[model samples]
Target chain A: EDKVVQSPLSLVVHEGDTVTLNCSYEVTNFRSLLWYKQEKKAPTFLFMLTSSGIEKKSGRLSSILDKKELSSILNITATQTGDSAIYLCALFMEYGNKLVFGAGTILRVKS
Target chain B: NAGVTQTPKFRVLKTGQSMTLLCAQDMNHEYMYWYRQDPGMGLRLIHYSVGEGTTAKGEVPDGYNVSRLKKQNFLLGLESAAPSQTSVYFCASRRLRITNTGELFFGEGSRLTVL
Candidate 1:
């Protein structure tokens, strides 16, 4: 079965702290990896990583995929309370283009 | 652009009642999908459509039905609502030719409650 696992299901950090969330997956015919941030409603798209060693960044958030290791990491720098939310990582398969998501990492950034 | 839209943001249904959730996307995307999110659990795929008149089951398709009569619309139906079926449903769409870059745009979820 295709599976995605996220470490440290929940985390708490003070404002301005740097945090790293991890996501590992094992699936056949992997196409790409995507990260999303969910606050209260639907999840918003963050980044999509396909090639290994290439980092995708958006402001304070960045992510990279290591296909060989079958894992990815999302890093947030100088985090704020606004960054506190559930971060989700998903692996997209080639055949059906289906997404298998990890039980997201709930980040709590306190001021 | 309206991006993606879901009808009836919230609903409550009796154990045996039936209802349908509608999803529409204005991005003119060729691929559309339906998913359910439960507490503590990650989103799970229910059904998807590659284009108009085509539909396929995903990881969790049981107790649900879907229809894609048009390219911009996808609908999810529950014939008999059960407590287990209560979840937040999301609709997503993506471009067809961008296979390697699997970026999906999602709609505001519809929260369903079954009693």
Candidate 2:
């Protein structure tokens, strides 16, 4: 069965701390993976990774994919209280035009 | 553009009640989806449509139904609500093209409570 699993189901950190969230998948015909941040409501896109070895970054957030390991990691540097939210990992299979998601990691950045 | 919009941001129903959540997208996306989120279960796909007049079951499609009568609209119907079905439902849409990034645009989810 195709599934995505995230580690450290919940985390707590002080401001200015760095945290890494992990996502691993087991699916047939892998295509791409995406990261989303959910606050009080809907989730917003954060990054999309299609290839391995390369890193995608935006300000204090970065992510990398390792296709060989069938895993990905999202790193947040200098966390802030505003950064507290649920981080979600999603993968798209080459078939079915469906996006499978993992149970998100709840992040709490204390000030 | 309104992007993706879901109706009835919140609803409460008794067991065995029926209701429908409406999702409309203005981005001309070719694909639309409905997902439910429970406390610790994260988000699970309920149903999706690749194009107008088509619908398919996803990982968690039981107790729910869907319809896509138009290119921009997808509707999720609960034939008989149950306490276990109380959850936050999210609607998303994405364009279907090889060149596209395959990013899904989401709407503010609908919160449903079955008592």
Question: In model 2, how large is the Cα lDDT of residue A75?
Answer: 98
TM per candidate: 0.97, 0.98
Backbone atom clashes (below 3 Å) for every candidate = 0, 0
Looking at model 1, residue B8 earns an lDDT score of 87
lDDT of 1 at A44: 92
Q: What is the alpha-carbon lDDT of model 2 when measured against the actual structure?
A: 0.94
Off by over 4 Å in 1: B98-100
Across B7-107, the per-residue lDDT of candidate 1 in tens digits comes to: 98999999999999999999999999999998778899999999999999999999999999999999999999999999999999988884457788899
Error of 1 at A101 (Å): 1.2
Question: Residue by residue across A1-111, what tens digits does model 2's lDDT show?
Answer: 788999889999999999999999986476789999999999999999999989999999999999999999999999999999999999987888888899999999998
By DockQ, the best candidate is 1
DockQ of each: 0.80, 0.77
lDDT of 2 at B32: 99
The list of candidate 2 runs beyond 4 A from truth reads none
lDDT of 1 by residue, A1-111 (tens): 789999779999999999999999877477788999999988998998888999999999999988888899999999999999999999888878778888899999999
List per-prediction Cα lDDT, in the order shown. 0.92, 0.94
